[model samples]
Target chain A: MVAALRERVRLACSWCENAIGFIQESRLPNGARRVGAGTMAFRMFIIGLVLVGSLAAAPAAWAYSESDPSANPDIDPSDCESCHTGTPEIAGTEEARQGPHANYSATSRSCYACHQVHQAYADGYLLMPGATTTETCELCHDGTGGKGVYGALEARGLAVASQHRTEVTTQIPGGDEATGGMATAALSGYQGTLSCGDCHSPHGGGTVEPFTTDRSRIETDVAGFFSNQLLRRAPTGATYEIGVYGSDWCAACHSGRASGVHDLINHPVDTSATVGPTAFTYESVQVVDGVDSPQTVQGSLGRSNFGYVMPWPRTAGQGTHAPVCQQCHEDGRSVGDVASGRIKASEVFTVTSADGGTAGDNPRFQNFPHESYVENLLIESYDDLCSNCHHPNQLP
Target chain B: MTPDAAVTPVNSRMRIRRSMQILSAVLLVVLLVLLVLLFRELLTGAPEYPVSQEGIRPLHVILGPGVGNRPFFDGPMGVTFGADGRIYVADSGNHRVVVFDSEGEYLFQFGGLGVGKPAAGIEPSWKPGLFNYPTDICSDDVGNIYVADFRNDQIQVFDADGDFLRVFPDRNEPLGRGASGQDGAGIAVTSLTVHGERVYATDTYQVAVFSTEGELLDQFGRPGAEPGDLDHPNGIAVGAPSVVVVSNSNRNQVLAFAPGGRFMWSFGKPLGNDLAGLSGELELPRGLTIMDDGTVLVADALADSIVRLTLAGEFDGRFGTRGAAPGQFNAPMDVDEADNRLAIAEKGNDRVQVIVIED
Candidate 1:
């Protein structure tokens, strides 16, 4: 029965492909592509002009959601997506199957369309007409599925508490208020609704990551896992482990210089030699180890969104060097290679999950999934984790 | 050849090539249009550049002269012109009050640095012979200049000729002697503006209306980030009905209060690199003054320029660049309007410049 259910799911996925192909073949009544490349491009160009030009004028335009009801509903998510579904057989239904945003739209009906291509995020873009930063996520996943799980966790007080909408009501200096200039908080807070577009990119890939980009413009030699096979382009061809690079996506909102939200990251104003090296050392896109640099998890990638501070290894004795993430996440210890910073390929990573079992502590435990270590992986990226080895006396 | 190779044609390559040529042509056209628009905006916006006008450089007269450490801000600082056209300065830096003519000549200097004496507390610096940093000196309709002795936490009454009339003791809560977010700070009067029988005095943090005899009729403003909160409030100006403007220096914005202390609105952003080039134009707006036509002039100290804005906080245009030239200012601190003449105190340059502001 389970096999039959899985097969049915796979068949459902194929329905999207059939619809896109059918749309591609069928012409409009006049026999022209309903919205051909030229016309669509022209429309896109005009929209781009309106987006960029209107944004350049000032962010005070009050016409965002006021002009359109189908795209910008005052209440209820279902009503918002009603007019947003373009080609009933294609856009709203089929394209979602092969797309990551599909899961988001499947469960939610009310708020699944009328997406703000941009102008939806405080960090990435400006606010659209009629919608504040808090309304971005209501476009879809109005408390359903993965987003529902996350929201439920937050609502039930499992995750960090969000006073986002309420805290902004009171005016205070450096607090969140959105009124007369007298309210200081209005200028210091973030727009708090994480949307699907905030994390995923369904259009083109390559230079742009899921929701982030390599701002440093660093060049690398190692091929990114997802790009090599599909995009036929290697964005950063540098040998580095996964998970570490994903942290940059989180920093987009957390950084202190964010115009939308209160700067969550402690941005460096003046330099202190005690903190660590600044990002100014390298002029290229590739991350290079400086004379005195932070210990990168994958030898030379990046980790943690701490703007001013970088993590380093907690050294023991005199001249010992710590192993990389791959070496730390492998099997048992083997004394094979001595040179090239390569170990015997046996030293492994230690992961203590929420259930209290070390993932790879025992060589017999081979089928441990990587998700068990996600929380620990985030914690290790901080400087606080290094204190265990830097000051051994404090560690139990 | 293999069937697999034959099954996939090179059609995608040909299609991509055609698309590229179309994309390039479209991009070029778009770029050209953008360039033309930008060029037109640049050329038509300000056709004539700001030029220098001929004449003797206007002199900035520091009206009521007081002495502080080396520059000012000591016993006396505030200076204002009376309706009779006489200049009255707090001279709080020296604990004395001095009066000068419009031509920068001293007419009479009184009030010593110490506490006021019974018969002769009429010179610079009173008992202990030193007044604290008096922030403002303004004359009412009858030529009676009210001096805001900031540090002394009182308003001293003096005749236009520098005669010591009486002292208005600090009725504000005895907070303390220091300034830290406005708390624990004594009642340091910063500015005074009198309208008819009502006198509005903005202490360090509170805006109070007095009835000539120093009786506080009502006071508003607390130290917080709320709408009506005032942080380090200074420089009071009374305009149209119920329009009272106070400079909240700490917030880097001016708060407008209604006649009865009803919070009206606030304008201006804190000075920092964040607001730099907000409009592709640099500004660090401070010291606001309203013209007869409600044209607000802001002396942006850091931006080192004077910006003109509408009453609704719209940046109209800007004048004066960063310099010590004839029309330029080093640090234009305060502005006062009288008839068609505007008096600007250039703090860093230590001069008062008079400008014939054209509409």
Candidate 2:
């Protein structure tokens, strides 16, 4: 036995010595290992060299952790606060503190729960397990799996596109072909699965804000008023009294639209009066409505719709600005009346199509205070009224 | 000198005999050592696996899209080794069992998509044979093959050569407790280690264990994100002492369990290497088998590679790259280890690839 062991050791030593000699001979004037560029041939060579050995002998030495508790750390929102301070702190503000993501367990928010790091099994953007498929997010958003709050919309079945295609399977469009529909248009090219972060984000955009015209290239801010949350340093300290400027928040995905943002008026700057009125009337204000909002103008976000009390406040980059969902949905206090106190309201709009015709005089709605009288305006309680206007079945 | 040698003959003879015995013993010991080394190298690849490069001989085989006497069923689900040393393929597409020898020869076939017992007008090629999309297959110590009839949601047992051996428990009884139907799949018999005398299977939705008579013993691994959770557990294997290995494909990882389904450890990743963004690397690492040397081999389908991992969850390197070459595979699904050869059931290409471990 000792003789055999000795012989094995000698052989191994000789092999090692031979390898060392090869390495030495391969070295150039510089001391670094001569790693070639990333090419198929290079990769094949590396793989071949590594595989030229007996695997059954010692098994693999690389780590195999199907049950790696360490792989997924018990995420602490506070840990994220270091770089994500402004938003969460803003969310922590009195107006947005009660949302499920803000109040749930530290890691329970749809953000961390779904966006995992190092998801080798998933597509791009390391999605969490089960989250590998967009259906994973749909499990909660779609009605089929868990009781998804958004799933309630599917029950209405107004041509609701499968979340699968809108988020997972498809790629985000870019450049000239990049129709910013993912954010504003109801339909999507994404075919695999959908995740909450696909539409919303704790970081607003990503490393860089999406629609900022400013070349400074700052992280998308999802704080302050809806119009500026996802755009550049959200207009320092601009405050609104009547309503959020819609065009300022529509550009996140509606880059090609006349307004270059998301709102009823294609160019809010050019058609401001048309979008916002002294007495917010539905028929006049709804010209700004896009293809996604099927609920008509007269009944557009009627009193029954959440938009009645808290309208779908425009996000930053509406015309050339990037606005996050939180800009309009999470902010509980109206920019104009901070002292008026917090009002628990929603921002999802459900505007109907214009007239009976598929495209008859784009849905019109009165903006701000209006002299016109639409019975839909008197419904009261946006929570109840909004469902009528934006209810999934209400789509054109 | 001659006179002295003659006087002490008895002692001299005894000394010579003792020396001979010692020499023989030493030789025997050396021989045993050599044999041990050979077996260890062949199995463990030991100290360092696949001890030598000269010993490895890789082969790739494909099995279904449309060859063989009868093509695969709608779903080509699971494959397992029968006790009689035969490979039983659950040809879910054809709704039958495709039996083959270790050498890749198709011996005979049986069963078909049906709604009756194994013997009632069963046809190997037609529907009505008493089988419905057999998703998975397994074998016991006695050489009995258990087929997981997915659509019908039952386990049908068959003998060595392809004879029906009555379904263990009643077919009507829910095999996987919580997830009793379609999604409730992934079944296996627990060795004495996990439950003393019980059978274990995962509903893919929930985990359940049954007795020899097919009675429910215990259930665990609920579907959730918490520890001891199973998103989509597809395969399982019994390990030394009382460890159970469960493969959760959705999560792209594996879970180890104690005898009573207590959490042990988890490791592994998606099997595929394509980073095209659809999923992880361990792209559906389906089948798992523990060699006698305690090494584990995983057949990662999407990556089109056969991975060798240590019991402790370590990458021991891999064989079979991506391709249809002699040692490459498109989607190598399942594999079994016996003697010194690895019998891999390659699903995409349609034949079993054999790899010999020369270490």
Candidate 3:
């Protein structure tokens, strides 16, 4: 075995040296003479050496002993670890030591938690035993799956109102056309696509990184650098400090606004904005009926008196909050007084924030209102986008 | 002697050089063969047919412009094979039911506009037999036809010969509102099936049981994702020994219940695309029928095909694709089997096609 390993290493080194020499010789000096016969001969020799080396190493690289317990199964369990972490052969032990699940000593941070060994229920990357990728995530993130960090978000019932609802059924368009049917397109730049795996990697590698716009660019590095909270992209590792508007992750697709093209026309979403007093307070208003007495009804959020914070930026002035795209565009479902039509509202929400956490602890923000009769997935009326921070009656 | 020795040495060198050349040639040939094999494995390409059904083919199709100036179907939603060797179709958009013999001959037609009684406070323009959107049809042993009047919120019964018998729940009773508060009527009967003396119907959320005489016997279901709960239950079928199957379309699962409405077991998962059994999933399942061997055949509207599954909800196989051809379908809504032949109602294409399921 030692002799074979030494021979393989020697062959690899020889192949690399020959390839480099061939490249160096091919480059003629600036303003020098035409290509020479010696250069052609050297190129041929390098090609022959590479072919010979590859032929000799091919069988040794693919060899597997029949008697080995982990050798050559129908579904090679070890193949996943070649690129991903959380497997015995890769960084499973190290991830278990440092990952969020490390404190939960009882939890097994293996790939099996979110993936199946064979015959996956979903199409790509073989999601867990659940039928959908969202369901597999909900098994752990729905408060009952033994994970506590996400339990509060699940308890708020935001799945139906959030823009990133995992239950979206619209088929994503634009993929390999030769397959004869619609293929699953990548999450970035594709509208109406939602799944748990779209934003988070269950293997603990992190989320999808920003790639070039060119479709032909083949990314060799499957696992990019990590970010806090497993975010897809952030300016720095300390993502919580930077508000939702500051992060460039969503800009990968919604380039018009996130890329500052709509900066002047759009409402100010920066962290510097703060909610004024008398914004979210409640009151009853009376209206006269045709018959006799007046009828009283609870006023809308636009007419409220107490100030409330928008729920996107992690930190804002006291009594104020920031907003993200999710605050308005929820799962392509109807919201807030929208007329019922052929399309139906989703029954799940994807974003919610708990109160009493430290500043910049949750990027989703706090005190998100649940679904109401609002149109376009808004948590409140269009007037309330300003009234939630600025008093309607006091507006100029 | 010295000169001979030098020549011998040169001859040996020539032999060695020739041997090296042959070895290089052999290696090049082996490498080329390996490259060819690798390329073949990597680019095997897609299958010739989208769906794999060995010998199935369409035997005939029922097109428009029938005899005696009768109107053809604008959009056909449901189809059923009666015991008397006749095919009944709920010609939904035309507001009628068209009947045809087994040989693709148009036998007769009935239940056109102005054929039924209107409800109180409702205009006389719409009635029970006069369907706004007749979604499903079924038949029993005695050839009694049951038509699900979807918009009318009633089930209109007719004789095998296309004669209107009666309407269930009566026109006088106010239709109860649905869970979504959309239906002002009592129940929105989407699909139904008959077993012995009982009639089972799905009201988009619950399965209501009724006697043959149009009396409500019992009902069980609610809007939920849990067991015994239903979400847009569109299709219903009764299998051997009284097992009731309901296709929960939105949830993308099929729920089974015993004779007394006890939740038995549910199978299928929420898959946006069309697929077959356990590993395969369902999308917008609309109509289903139980075959003689207890296997269930479902017409998946979104998939535009017919999916066959075992009684235990295991996938067998499926056929049909989205097209306007004879063997193809454009949003197939329901499927029924008779005499080893299958009848499909194409809602999008406005036609009825019959095909044989070959072994």
Candidate 4:
């Protein structure tokens, strides 16, 4: 290991064109041996290379850690707040970026690690010269899997089989972004190209609800407004609001996909769910004979439709709940049997398409955010999804 | 070459000399440009993959994107070592089990075959051998691989060579007493750890124990706000004297239990942000591993460090910092120690860094 370190330091020195050479050997106060005599030692995040004295400690020497701070004092990146203080838009974002998206800190270069702030913006993004927006995200987000792999974020959300083409497009126009739609037109597909930034706020526009532990990223369960939709209210029971901004999140692009049998929007959206333990009423007022009255159909969440602990049918009772667009969709963790698979798309979507059969197989049949095992990104194909609300007990 | 060569020998010689001079001038310009470019490149501060003396991810192996035997991993959640000195990783994102040598070299993989990327175009099948999102993995004394099938609600067993062995505690068929105190099925098994004759698992809210032969050995825990009650439990381990410890991640606490499922005590407290978990404070602590001396090491994801404690709920010390570099960690999801080496499953870096964690 010491030999490898010496070679690496030699390469680093040679590459820098520095005339680094061994002046002599020395030892520190701790009696750790130091080889190679020079003026300075190269110390970094985890690298402790001695120039005048790279402390080639014994084989059992401890690595640099927080508890072992006394080992080396002069070169540790001990204090981040010393330089990280600023407006939330500036270095303050270092704390904001602490979610699953990866808390890039220290010599890893925090914000500048991904962005070349001073200059070298590529394709209008504040990234390094040659790196594209997708490359920056895929450095970790790609299926190879690291922290921010993106999904329901639950058990099933761990591995997304298919996902949005954030890499293929340039214009991430949606919701209220710079190029996103306005009050009337919130559809990215209706006009411009769609990318990841169109919906996700890298600086954490969402947070975990009051009940759950505090988290920064706006994931499936986190209840903060995004993409022209307000959803995922806290405390999963009756009275939990669904889609405060109208349950048409996916409808921004998918209200009507085609005209033939391929029409996407089948199940109703923005309606009160009849089954469940408790359900928040979307519209509390009922116009009875030209006179307004309280909500007519109060609902509750029941045992899950597909027999899983989900938002819709978790606790069963006589309460009426408002079902939103996400009730039948795949989350970061899709509602699937980890031992089996999610959605059973092979059994659900049996129709073979032109390119063969896209039983949740092709990227085209996949949905936004992430892919699903079934067609149209449905949690289950056809009548099975509808059973979560209508004909709850009739589902097999 | 005919009459022209005879007529203009002197003129041809002059023309050749002129051409040579023009070529020399162009060559000199090219050489000067090359030298200037080389000088700039040499003068550049650091190498392109910049890491100032951290020396580029010391002794790390990238578990990667279909780069040969290393199947493209989605998210690797769990890692364990077998008696044979081979390593087993739960490639959760790919819904498969990936095997590697003790040295972190890719060996082979199984599962992940479905209507997905690595298995796309193939007919989808919900075969029991296939997996959904297998979170954590462990190996019994005999090298039988046990996977915490997080979504499937079952523990799928496999042979050392990656064959489909029997599954434990039938799926959704109700374990022993659950957090609900009722016979509830379909518990999400997020993490797991193995002892001599038992396999301990954390199902988000409770700990379910299973025998080597797939029997429900015992089950305990409840969903409540009390210290003994578990809320979002993950990462479990069993000590020598039969102390079962678990990390209640959501509540940021680690609890210990007796062999027969008795609550011993709960340890863990968030000291302060300034402390950085160096004093054994926990922030979102998950993935518990026990040393030979019954020392417990908990990987605190949010703090980007590891908290060392004892089965008796004593705060030892801690190490690690916040970064994606060697000797540093970024959202370290899991940690396992064997053969005096620590294999860290880094959720942020998307790779397992094998480093020696000594005193």
Q: Which digits, one per residue and each the tens of the lDDT, describe model 4 over residues B110-150?
A: 88633211233434344666787777888887888888776
**What residue runs in model 4 are displaced by over 4 Å at the alpha carbon?**
A1-396, B1-74, B114-129, B172-187, B270-280, B323-325
The chain B TM-scores of all candidates, as shown, are 0.67, 0.69, 0.77, 0.76
Q: For residues B1-359, could you state the per-residue lDDT of candidate 1 as single tens digits?
A: 88767755656555655565566566546545654554453445321212342322345434234343333322123556767776665553355666667766657666654533211123323443236545566667788878776545567777777667766644234333222111122344666777677777765356777778776677776654466676545567777655877766544566788767788877765322222212223222334567778777666543445666666656687666433344655445556666656666544334455665443
Report, to 2 decimal places, the DockQ of model 1. 0.01
lDDT for predicted candidate 2 compared with the true structure = 0.42
For B1-359, candidate 3 gives per-residue lDDT tens digits of: 79889799778766655555555556557656755543443355211222323356887678643655654576677899999879999887677888888877888787765423332243456544566557789998899999887655578898899777888865335433321111123445778888888889886467888887788888777654466677667789999988898887655677889987889887766421122211325544778999989988888765567888888878888776544456766557788889789999976556898988765
For each candidate in turn, the TM-score is: 0.37, 0.41, 0.44, 0.52
Candidate 1, residue A152: lDDT: 21
Worst 10 residues of 1 chain A by lDDT: A213-222
Compose the digit string of candidate 2's lDDT tens values, residues A1-396: 123344445554564465456546554678755543223233333333432342222222121222344644664432444445566322332212111123222332323333332211212234322323343343222211121124221221212222223343333222112443333233222443333443333233221122211110010111211111222222211122212323323223333332423443332232233333332222113322332332323222222222322223332213322222222221111121122211223223222210100111111121111111122222222434343223333336
| Candidate with best lDDT | 3
Give each prediction's DockQ, rounded to 2 decimals. 0.01, 0.02, 0.03, 0.05
Of 3 and 4, which scores higher on TM-score?
A: 4
Number of the top DockQ candidate: 4
Worst-scoring 10-residue span by lDDT in model 3 chain A: A213-222
Tens digit per residue, CA lDDT, model 1, A1-396 = 122234434543453355345546545777787765655545445544543454334222211222234554444433334544453222422221211223224343212122333222222223221133333332112121011112222221122212123213433222222321222222212443223222232221222222111111011111221221111011122122112222222222222221223324332221112112321211111221332233332222222121111323332211232222221222221211222221122422222111111223322111111121223222233333343233333335
Supply the DockQ value of model 3. Answer: 0.03
Tell me candidate 2's TM-score on chain B.
Answer: 0.69
Q: Please, what are the lDDT tens digits per residue for candidate 3 over residues A166-257?
A: 44533332122233233454342124345554444344343332221101101112123122223332221222222222213433333333
